[model samples]
Target: MISQFFVLSQRGDNIVFRDYRSEVAKKKDGQEEAPPVFNVDGVNYFHVKVVGLLFVATTRVNVSPSLVLELLQRIARVIKDYLGVLSEDSLRKNFVLVYELLDEVIDFGYVQTTSTEVLKSYVLNEPIVVDAARLQPLGPAAIFMQGTKRMPETAVTKSVVANEPGGRKREEIFVDIIEKISVTFSSSGYILTSEIDGTIQMKSYLSRNPEIRLALNEDLSIGRGGGSIYDYRSLSGSGVVILDDCNFHESVRLDSFDMDRALSLVPPDDEFPKRDNLKLK
Candidate 1:
């Protein structure tokens, strides 16, 4: 369980702080320079960085490191989803909203709900929108990109509760097929190893909560060699793609997956990964 939660700026300023259990002492100056996770006087610290700010949690009990780290990340994402932009200025401007979110997300050091949709009814304060243009550039790279003809930003940055000019919520959903590929080559310039890690991410702004149907390639095969689970064709063919393993969210239905290689489900109102850890070859 979390004993305390806080946000620190890059310069070690405590921007937002909450002591649920009051088990940990007040943070000392320069504490932000410590490692992401550390232990001092039987107290454990876990923190995650997002947009140059630190989201930190403290505890005395021995909790799962991964679980605490993921909680920090999810908390950061929840704040970003509400504020539309995550920065020190934004957090300062919407501190009331932030505190309200913290109250709903955690109950006296115990996690309640991190889902943005679930928190909507409980979070009474409206977020103060931050103008992305007025903020300082993230880094030198951001300045360099300003002159380039970049594609329009995706809906991911928009707040889930934001309304249009006529108080109408846009009915749209976004699906992203993100993949990371790794390749190793021998000194002879021959490929020694190649693999792909992919995920299907989804975010919904639709109010009706309509069911979604997502179809995969007909020639897609699972596993290696001719003994693949889905297809009988050889994997050496150019048109065929092979996936060694994949996992889906609990909300997904696989009734037609065996025959049509399709997935059906009603997406959650907030952003979530529909599929994860897809190993491809």
Candidate 2:
């Protein structure tokens, strides 16, 4: 769980700060805060520097510290993708949308949703006029201020407005499977070591929440239509590309794949690598 979140500038200035904890224990009886720097006595911090900003998250309890850093990295990417860059000026200019985004990305230190496509659907690229009607609820239980929400009186580009429906377009998807093979030979032309690396990348422009499944064969041979059909036992004597210890994208359903060896997923808009590397020895 996240206890506190902060965005500081290169000069160590607080750009934006959010606290998930309802009450902050004072350093002493009357002290309003701890030392502003990341290193306080007991608080554990995980921060990453990105684009002239110090993205920091503080946690009072023991938790996976790397998760906070990962969340911050994703937030940086989302902001950069939506606002063009991740600078103090951009943060100030688009503070409204930034706040809205942070609320959507995380809630009470638990990751809510970091899907850029879904976020982009609601978060536009222009300025927003925060109003009762424009500030749409992300969902019944998504990013919202606990007590009350007051949008900052900051100006974004007038062209970018939230809750606009122009982004709803029919999408086209493309999939690419890449493999690289390298072999080393001795002076007598005797093979020393040969290795293969493979990756599956899919570019999806489909509408929101589309489930996709991509299946491949062990022998890397095409049978009927666009499919790979092979018998592993028969191919044991021959050569076949078997993906071992494969790593998948977050959109992939690992449980389903574990059950039937089918690559099932909800593809993001950008080209997502379905597997990290299919190594061959």
Top model number, lDDT = 1
The C-alpha stretches of model 1 lying farther than 4 A from their native spots are 31-33, 131-151, 225-238, 276-281
Q: What would the per-residue lDDT of candidate 1 be over residues 200-245, giving only the tens digit for each residue?
A: 9887888878889999887776665544332424335667766777
lDDT by candidate, in order shown: 0.81, 0.63
Off by over 4 Å in 2: 10-13, 22-39, 80-90, 108-111, 115-203, 208-244, 250-265, 269-272
Q: What is the per-residue lDDT of model 2 for residues 62-141, given as tens digits with 9 covering 90 to 100?
A: 77766777888888877754554456877888788788888887788778887767776665446333222244555754
**In candidate 1, which residue pairs get closer than 3 Å at backbone N, Cα or C atoms, i.e. clash?**
none
Model 1, residue 205: what's the lDDT?
84
Q: Candidate 1, after superposition: displacement of residue 135 in Å?
A: 14
Task: Give each prediction's root-mean-square deviation over alpha carbons.
Answer: 4.7, 14.6
Report the number of clashing residue pairs per model: 0, 3
Which pairs clash (backbone N, Cα, C closer than 3 Å) in model 2?
126-160, 127-157, 127-160
